[model samples]
Target: MRKLGTVLAALLVIMTAGWAGNAEAAKGIVIDGSTTVGPIAKSFAAYFMKKYKVPVTVSESGSGNGAKSLINGSCDIADMSRSMKPQEIAAAKARRINPVANVVALDCLAMIVHPSNPVRALTEAQIGDIFSGRINNWRQVGGPNFPIVVIQRESNSGTQETFKELVMKGRAVVSGAETQASNGAVKNRVSQTRGAIGFVGLGYLDASVKKIAVNGVIPSAATVKNKTYRLSRDLYMYTNGKPAGVVGTFIDLPKTPDGRRIIQELGFVPKY
Candidate 1:
């Protein structure tokens, strides 16, 4: 009788421990990052919650802030439009976090202007000059004589970093350039202002604004996937170490058929 009682107590203890562990693992997932990657993350979150019954929250505070959130342990996934910078990796290592990137999609920074603007293409050098204030009039670029309104993303934006590296080639943006918070915001401003020019992820393109060719190459899913678009970059989701449990499933969603459809629907190119 004594032995039987001891065995049952041990089994109960094991069961209780397992339940506690499950409860901890069920605490849900948090995602933070770029407005460029926001639509994909939100759509994936919705699908995950419906299919797996796992609660997930997503926030688009820009890529720099996404790295900060992951390093600070505030988010499980960091959606970034660019690779983690060296400093961000060092910061994560300092916090005992191993940052791992999963490429989820491909995107290009599409130069956009008002639909009424007839200037349809720009060489990379010309764009650099325009944004840097060297070429500030529409007439100089084969359009009506209107003062060009140059728009840029905030300094903390990954999109801004990419634009500076890819298009600006170390040139500083004009001191008078306007700054917007997100891809959607830039698209909105460009759509409303005839003389305005801005850049946004390919996903943000719509009839509200017109996309211009960069160096004679127009941005399209095929163009981005085939590497014909020079401005193409990979979109990423960063996690601490290898993701396991629900986090693993969520991060790998891009490899699934439904995820590809969702990416296409949102105007982004699926990487897997």
Candidate 2:
């Protein structure tokens, strides 16, 4: 009778473990990547989980890591503010992963300064000079004689990449520039530091920091859509191959009216 009881107990444990595995598999849609896209992803995830009754998770690991997560099959979607690099495509192809980019929204990579800074608009050439360390004083740009505090995002950030491509024009950022890990971090640093200039996704812009116009073009829906906002870029969620089933449903959220509302509410442009 003791032997029989032991066998029954072991069987129950096995069944419980199997049940846990099924639960784990049931909670499978995972999203990871860009801090710039974090708010949108989180909002979409909340809507998805609430409406569909499926478990979903979102992580803001930066765009590069998000690509890595998708490449490694750890995530269902990799959110990115910039297009995937050539080498990333090679790596994905080598691993038999076909990455398909779905543009979820649009963002104005806003140039921000401390709210107290008076320098309002900068020409493209001026911005290049400032970020490249050729111009280090706010006085050089018609402002007070304060030393410029140039803040930038870390190398792993898609926002940093887009900034480099658009504003830097192949010039390396000044080595003395301060680097932060995420959009929020950069925003916070710029907000606290006088004469600081940094860039962040438009969603992160608020009263805490002031935005500067680029080349006389103020960032707005009309400007960006008209191609006058040079800092505007498309936001993306990449999937392995084309998404299907629930993955398709989640990826397509940005196209729906509710998704568009969420995007607009978060201060990002919708890609209707």
Q: What TM-score goes with each of the models?
A: 0.90, 0.92
**All-Cα superposition RMSD per candidate:** 8.5, 3.7
What is the C-alpha lDDT profile of model 1 across 96-194, one tens digit per residue? 999999999999999999999999998888999999999999999898999999999998798999999999888899999999998988998999998
In model 2, state the lDDT of residue 181. 96
Q: Considering every candidate listed, which one attains the maximal lDDT?
A: 1
Backbone clash pairs for candidate 1 read: none
**Best candidate, TM-score:** 2
Candidate 1 segments exceeding 4 Å error: 1-26
Least well predicted 10-residue stretch by lDDT in candidate 1? 21-30
In model 2, the runs with Cα more than 4 Å from the true position are: 1-22, 25-27
> Which residue pairs clash in candidate 2?
none
Candidate 2's residue-wise lDDT over 67-147, tens digit each? Answer: 999999899999998999999999999999999999999998899999999999998899999999999999999999999
Location of the lowest summed lDDT over 10 successive residues in candidate 2: 21-30
- Give lDDT for model 1: 0.94
Residue 65 lDDT in model 1? 97
